[model samples]
Target: MDGRRSDTRERIRAVAMELFTERGYEKTSLREIAERLGVTKAALYYHFRTKEDIVASLSDDLRRGIDDIVSWADATPAGPERAQEILTRYGALLHGLGRDMVRFWHENQPAFRELGFGVGLRYQFRVLADLMTAPEHAPLAVFHARQALLALSWSISMMGDLPLDDDECYGAASAIASDILRRM
Candidate 1:
């Protein structure tokens, strides 16, 4: 029973993201999501009462994943190797989570800011950069670290229309990011 319920919820989220992508987040509606899912609005409401709720649910997963990376980095000895691993893990997490969600994030910055999701994520991003440099936290190194992270993130959101497959594009992005990190 629980598994079925969880499946239903995931289905709703998937359909909702599809519709949101097609129609634009602000233009999409709960009715449209339910219609796309072939489910009643009430049934959709049983899982998510509003579009914001759906977005929030997706953001929560991303936040938790980043938090886990931060926790792991905390215990690890920090240096170039740790920073490189952090970039690798961060890219894997973002890419593994789902391209649609990252696309939604890229396209819906205003919505994220409006909902206060950006603050926590921005904080976590800085934390990751800090972890990259640990004790020194040198301004230049941190800047490079942040840029490396951005390369992984922007590759997901901005490179979707490229001819390359996900692995190829992600691999290129990871390489670029690693190069950037090595500069610091």
Candidate 2:
């Protein structure tokens, strides 16, 4: 029963994101989300009070996922293997966030910033970079690390129109990430 309730919440979020991406975030509303989900506005309200709540919910989930990576990286010994693991874990996390959130995040950056999701995510990313190039912190090494992380992230949103599928892109991006760490 609890699992089904959790599923209903996820379904609501998925429908809300579809509406948000189809019609810009500012243009989507709770009524439209409920209608699209074939539920009453009150039922939708049981989970999310506003459109911002929906976005916030997804962002919160993402933040928690990144937080887990950061915590693990902190506890793990500082080494290249740990860096690779961090990148791999982050890749898996972004993949689970769904393509719609990726599209919505790219297409709705200003709104996400306005809602304050950008700061926490940006900070978490910096922690990952630090984990990747800790102790020495050579400028060039840090640069490559940042670029590698960027490529891993871009695999989620920017490669949608490309010929490759999700696994192909993510696998390639992660390989590039490993090579970058090797160089450092």
Clashes of 2: 0
Residue-level lDDT tens digits of model 2 in 40-83:
99999998898888899999998899889989988898878887
Candidate 1 colliding pairs = none
Give the alpha carbon lDDT tens digit for every residue of 1-184 in model 1.
9999999999988888888777899999999999988989999999999999999999998999999999998889878888989999999998886667788888989999999999999999999999998889999999999999999898877887888777887888899999999988
When summed lDDT is taken over every stretch of 10 residues in candidate 1, the lowest stretch is 95-104
Worst lDDT run of 10 residues, candidate 2, spans: 151-160
- Model 1 Cα shift for residue 60 (angstroms): 0.3
* Maximum-lDDT candidate: 1
Q: Global CA lDDT of candidate 1, please?
A: 0.90
Model 2 ranges with Cα > 4 A deviation: none
In lDDT terms, how accurate is model 2?
0.85
